[model samples]
Target: MSQSEQPWWRGAVLYQIYPRSYLDTNGDGIGDLSGITRKLDYIASLGVDGIWISPFFASPMKDFGYDVSDYCAVDPVFGTLEDFDQLLDRAHGYGLKVIIDQVYAHTSDAHAWFEESRQSRDNPRADWYVWQDPKADGTPPNNWQAVFGGAAWTWDARRQQYFMHNFLPEQPQLNVHNPEVQDALLATARFWLDRGVDGFRLDAINFAMHDRAFRDNPPWDPAGRTITRPFDLQRRVYNQSQPEVPEFLERVRRLTDEYGDRYTVAEVASDDPLPTMRAYTKGDERLTAAYSFDFLYASTLTAGRVRRSQGNWIGPLEEGWPSWEFSNHDAPRCVSRWYDGPDRPRFAKLMNALLLCLRGNPILYQGEELGLTQVDVPFEALQDPEAIANWPRTLGRDGARTPMPWEEAGPNAGFSSGKPWLPVGPDHPGLSVGVQEQDLDSVLNFTRKLLTVRRGSPALKWGELSFLDVPESLLAMTRTCEEESLTCLFNLGAEPVEIPEPVNLGGAVLSQSEGLIDREGRIMPPYAFVILRD
Candidate 1:
């Protein structure tokens, strides 16, 4: 398809808004749908093509909004369904697509389906959840471990069986293998589609299916690595990543196809995610795109890492599109994880440029454009259940989930009239949107310019990518459309690096470092990057 005729999501820049932290319009200290609507103009100013709002469904707040109780209802803390409709209409009015999260793998124990299923074995929805009988010795069903900790199977006395849970005990696994359960989930999706949602970001989709036989997962060799949780000690051979997952995905795609131009992207996190990511989005019958934790959890950013990530998606026509995210609500902010140098602002701009230059859709998390750093949330204030359970060992997701700073001076940085549900970062005030708006050289403005360039350039938006020969510290590649081509170069290291002799540095279209480029073979300073029309 030609660039203009392509789907709206192809190579789109999606801005992710974590509803709890984006902005709180009500005095509840938690952000709501109305808050997102209030900020639609600010989000539109960033030049993003769409917004991906994380789960705001009715939940018990055990895993935040992940443990959903009612699939169709909005949590009272957020707003009513009417509020969401207004947010959707306003977002569309700003020419931005709206993509909401769908947690299909499990639901809060308080859900009517789970509540009824656990009441008795002969209940109509008894088979809707994964319930297994105990072993001969009265031990739990299998060796599967929950993602949070301890045994995956939780004992329910009413049913006299151990029910499965992949995360917290409150979130029970749904037996997606059951045709009735699949039909119900599809109905929920259809409900949203009818309500005018442009797409869905399927959360932890690989965990939706499990091994029906309840076999033990083989022990995974740590290879001298210190294991944090028992869950990390197993290969997860049968707990998830079932062969039938693609079949279910085909059904999801078919449902989405009914809504013209609708999109679906799966979030797949595994020890080896490329294979599953490929499988989940391999063809037209599956998801439109899928993203992994490859870049999210990386300790460092390097040329080879970027090359391999990009190279994996370059393949035959049957291969599905990919989505890339450097930071999110779950992962620590990239500025804190990747670079600790004095010149963090420079590094942030370079990273932003690199993300937009990639071939796939680039997902920019809230506060990323402001160069936000991970906060050091204290033990007393930590809210993440996984982190609380494994304290001092893990860097808890609370640091990354802190409230976004909007003003330099405020009670909680103007994120709320009341104290935010999560603490705002100490340094976030200086990097607040109010502070960056006045400074033209700020990372926030630089990101806006870079996004504008990407939106206007066919090569950056819809081009095929090919790596160019360059030094170890530098990443060089070319993005080419039919008649347009642009060369992108990044200096990932602390020291200066020279471009190879064969490459042409051509006139700079967009650049980070001021005095680094020259007509002669150019040298890029620490964390510098440039894009040139070739």
Candidate 2:
């Protein structure tokens, strides 16, 4: 493809792989690098443009892989540096781009830089992290709190001061205000780019910079609260989404541009995410795309709700791009979250098809193709620190991060010969790849067909989205490019709906539920969708 022909991310589908739970090669109960290498063919068959691997760098696993010890090397638990090279080579061979996670906001306490900074306040590296003296009463510098639970600031006895840790105490937040620290992080990105990484999945990009004055955040009054997640109680204003974040983002953008076509997608989450996303991707030399938790947290599939969430793209996003995902390692599975009971399989198929037809790049979480639902983790069986800390009220993300189910009858669902870290979902065996591959009507096949349809039709990929004036229960829209026009009608309600006028297109190009044709017009089944050509 010529440079002009390739916009880098047009109509792309990025598959996310949570490294530790994807596959276990040695059966040490944890998934590793080589295990991911072995599954390259399977990923390629899904028609994804790239693979976004979550953090696999050296870490203490305090916040799972989000807490990095080494910015450049792969963790020994994952495999040697050689294994990453092999994985990269294999992924490229399959025509799949590799985007590794870049956790720039914080580092594991075990990191060399953190160790040096903690040794003494006057050390050369002491300013690398955010450190502050204690108040007269020996309390933390501010009312800031950690994202995991309480108090974002942690006191270091040696320095006789408190250091900012937005997450856990072991993961100290970096002082992006320091030019040296910014340069060091840029070097890390350059290292991966030099190693042939196509892009980066920036973890908590907005949190990289914080207000220096340590101001108190306003209180948030949530309609309800999760017992396990205290962070939800307070509105996180001062501690995150700092004003200086986009300034550093422009620098990261400049660094990525050195290697042509290298993309960066920021994982942005805040009460005001649309504004932050707009700021991050506003200019020409900034992030390629930004994703927030708008869709992931929503439990309703209503037309008005979906339209309000997705259709409301603010700022320069219309010129820029967006990355959307229904589920990831952090959130509960979409299928299980929205639809329960026997009809879940059908709903899951419909949801996949619906997502594929949307405007921006789509991301498929591992095992989403197989129609995997969230597994119920018991109190004793849970291994996620976040879940363990906030148990009863919050459904810890670990349930969605279980080992991939490859084979129905094989041991450990053929994920590994060794014991897996987390138990596979109970229905995983029936929903395994082996079983789904044989069943033509399976969710996996439905997803593949939907992707193929979208890939074949340029209208659905790069077209403009305009909402059609339809009933509240029906989501009606049209996607059109210069050459082609397609109309998509979805019945989000449980009861059947009938459109009074004839569809603009000749017939539906794809649908999960049955498409009904009547003298009045196209009769849509309950929760059915149709794609018509005008």
Candidate 3:
């Protein structure tokens, strides 16, 4: 199919906005729908096709916005439903699709459904959540551990039973296997679709269901990996990624299909996520795309790693499209995770070019275009539950969730007139949008140019990726679409490497590096990349 005839999201770029950190227009130190509306122009200027706003639903601030208290109401902190409508309208006005998050796996303990479910054993909503009776020994239903820490099942005195939670105790797991629960979740989707949302990013959909038998999760070997929490020691077979999860997704797909061209992407995170990701998006009956933790949590970015990750999705179209992200609200920034050198600007540009040239859709986190690195959030000010639970061992996600720095000089780098909920990175002022807007050579400007180039090229936007035979330190590939082709080369190592013979380097459409390229096969500088028209 031609690029113009393909689905709008097949190879489109999405910008992820963490609502709490994007911009706080209310001076309450938190970003709201109105704040996002105010920044629509800036996001549209990034050349991304859509904006994936993290949860701004009715949340109780536990686990931030991930724990939804009400599926159909906007949290008072994020303004009213009218504010979201205005934001969505403004985003569409700027030609940007707005995709909101749907946390179907669980809801805040404060949610009316969960509250009613936990009230009594015989309540009308007793079975609305995953409630189970304790064993004769008074232990949890089984050996399941929460993602944050401790036992996954928490005791409830009222019901005298235990409730399961994949992440936090305050966020109880929902009984999505129940048809009624599925109907309610689908109704929530219909509510947003009725509100004119372009799509939904399903949060941890793999954890929506559990083993009905409540079997014990098999033990997992650390295999030279650090053991942070008890949850890390289990293979996580029984607790999540159940066989029935995809069946629920089929219903979600059918509902979304009712709304034309509506996109649905699921966040599938587990020990082995590729298979589940594929299953969740295998055909038109499931999700449009799914992204895993392959690149999100990687400590290093290498040619072989990228090859393996991309190779999985390079088969037939029925295998489904994948979405790649180098940074997001859940993990540390990529530039800081992958590179630890003095010349971060050059490395940032190289990574940007590499991401945009990949085979599938690319999701860019806010402030990524400006080369923002992870901040160092102190323990006293730590806001993330996982970070506080596993402190001093993990770098924690708070660093990446810091507020975006808009101006060089401001109360909180222009993120808010008052103190930001999270501190802006100390070094982010130098990389602020105001600073980079004037510099043509800045990473921000380079990102704009790179995006424009990708959008204009059919091969780069909707192409088949084939890795070239190159050294381990180098990643060379070609994105071919019908008659158009482009060669993408990246030096993923510290030392320079030579470009092999027979690889075309004549038409250098875009290049980033401190080294030179010549006709006789020149040495590519450390972290350099070039995109050539073939």
* Top lDDT hit: 1
Alpha carbon deviation, residue 19, candidate 2 (Å)? 1.3
CA lDDT for candidate 2: 0.83
lDDT of 2 by residue, 217-244 (tens): 8887877643356677777788888888
Model 2 root mean square deviation, Cα atoms = 2.0
Runs in model 2 deviating more than 4 A are 1-4, 224-228, 314-319, 500-521
Query: Positional deviation of 263 in candidate 1, in angstroms?
Result: 1.4
Worst 10 residues of 1 by lDDT: 510-519
Q: Quantify all predictions' global Cα lDDT against the true fold.
A: 0.90, 0.83, 0.89
Candidate 1 Cα outliers beyond 4 Å, as residue runs: 224-226, 519-521
For candidate 1, write residues 400-437 as lDDT tens digits: 98988999986989899998888989999999999999
Alpha-carbon error at 134 in model 1, in Å?
A: 1.2
Deviation (Å) of 479 in candidate 1:
0.8
Candidate 3 wrongly placed segments (more than 4 Å): 511-515
Per-candidate clashes come to 0, 7, 0
Please write out the lDDT profile of model 3 over residues 44-101, one tens digit for every residue.
8889899999998888888898999999999988889999999989999999999999
Q: How much is the lDDT of residue 453 in candidate 2? A: 81
List the candidates ranked by lDDT, beginning with the highest.
1, 3, 2
For every candidate, C-alpha RMSD to the true structure in Å: 1.2, 2.0, 1.1
Predicted structure 1, TM vs. truth: 0.98
Q: How far is 269's C-alpha from truth in model 1 (Å)?
A: 0.7
